[model samples]
Target: MWKTMILLVLVNVINGQCSCSKFTDESSCFAYGYCLFVNGVCVEQKCEAIPYQEKCKSPLCLWKDNKCLTFKAAESTCQTLLPQQCTEYQGCYYDYTNLKCQISNNCSKLEIDQCNGQLGNGNSCIVDPFNNKCQEMTDCKSLSTEFMCLSQFPFCLYQNSSCKPSSCNEINDSVSCSIMDQCQWNNNKCEIKNCQSIKFGYQCNGKTCGFDKDQCFSCIEQYGYQFFAGLISLLFIL
Candidate 1:
């Protein structure tokens, strides 16, 4: 029985040393068959377990950018408010290879403000994407909201924010007269009047403004005459 026990122990030791192994490169037969050695001969017993990244998702796109990515690198490109927390947005996909936001087509842009000329032009549905103050523009020049696209592909502006000049030449368009002031439309020829506008200086009371040179000169002359008369009166008294 003692001899049987010793034989079993011996078998285990030998099996540990000759265990079947697997590796990446089959061309290198030296690492294939034999078990990996801690202090023994160099061989791989099994391939190392590769780490996997958690999946991310968004309402519009499910499972965006499933490629392996480092946390810092992924967070830099992706805007996950709760990186540590297992939130719903965590499933939104982020593609590290191209650094892009991928999501569902149903993802839509929310309205930040009612379309107004406040942006210095006129369109509608100017929106702030991702709660960021940055406003997406379709085309500031043409004011086309459709052209405005974001990196996340989740948010977009519905329309342009400002007014644009007409591209057609078919009909006469009334241009704003404030630009050139007095506008005259004669024979379809709009003529604008140019005036040498003047500005009033300070000391202008109510309706008037600027120094009265004529009034100032008269006051100076009166003071000089008073001084001369006072000198003559002193000489006569002496």
Candidate 2:
């Protein structure tokens, strides 16, 4: 009986090691809790093998009790968190007046960093010039300054002393559009540059595009899952 139990344990360990080897790509391999892509091959992973706390945040590993461990879903409510922990928890903020962690929907209550960090469905939270409150920026016309307009590159443009939605074909000056990150001079006319043609990190902007690790990346592809996950968590609490 003891021999049979030992054989079963050995078989399970062997199967675990070999199972990850079947995955050929990084994305597919990393999707599984027990697998990791290493040296161009997919292999079995242990939470202890990961060194950094930030890197330990995937579905497979959790950083808790000052150690990396296999992830186990836990119900950590905002009301249960202490003042310091409340600030660390996503979508929850410490209310000093109320002296508790609370789910916040009012953008006006957020500070500059917190406001800017709130990204939802391609809309970014910005301080409204009229009310001096943080809110999702939806229209180009709301931007009153050239600096503000230009900051939303490829989406808004400063033209005729007003901020307006940009159109590559509407821009007549090849010299002016050429300097812009998303526009270029093409066939003697101003045209939007292809995102693939952007070689440097500084050149990528707009709602859908981003730069990471010296490579141009789609913002939707990169951050969509994380955004949705946070949204779902917020909804559950609400």
Q: After superposition, how far is residue 3 of candidate 2 from its true place, in Å?
A: 70
**TM-score of each model, paired residue for residue:** 0.16, 0.33
Per-residue lDDT of candidate 1, residues 1-238 (tens digit): 6555555444333222222222223332232232233443344322221122222222112232554332221333335433322122322333335444332111123223221111212122334444533353334343333334432121222324533322212123344322222332234544332121222322111111111321211112222466555545654555
Which stretches of model 1 miss by more than 4 angstroms?
A: 1-113, 117-142, 145-187, 191-193, 196-238
Among residues 3 or more apart in sequence or in different chains, the pairs in candidate 2 whose N, CA or C atoms overlap within 3 Å are none
**Could you give me the TM-score of model 1 versus the true structure?**
0.16
lDDT at position 74, candidate 2? 31
* TM-score computed on alpha carbons, candidate 2: 0.33
In candidate 1 the C-alpha lDDT for residue 71 amounts to 28
**Candidate 2, residues 1-238: lDDT per residue as tens digits?**
6555555444333222225555566765564345568999877768887655655653356576677776432335456556665544344555566676555445566764445422223345565554556665557887766766777766678889998977777777876776554566667888866655678755655433444345554433423466546554654554
**What's the lDDT for all of these models?**
0.29, 0.57
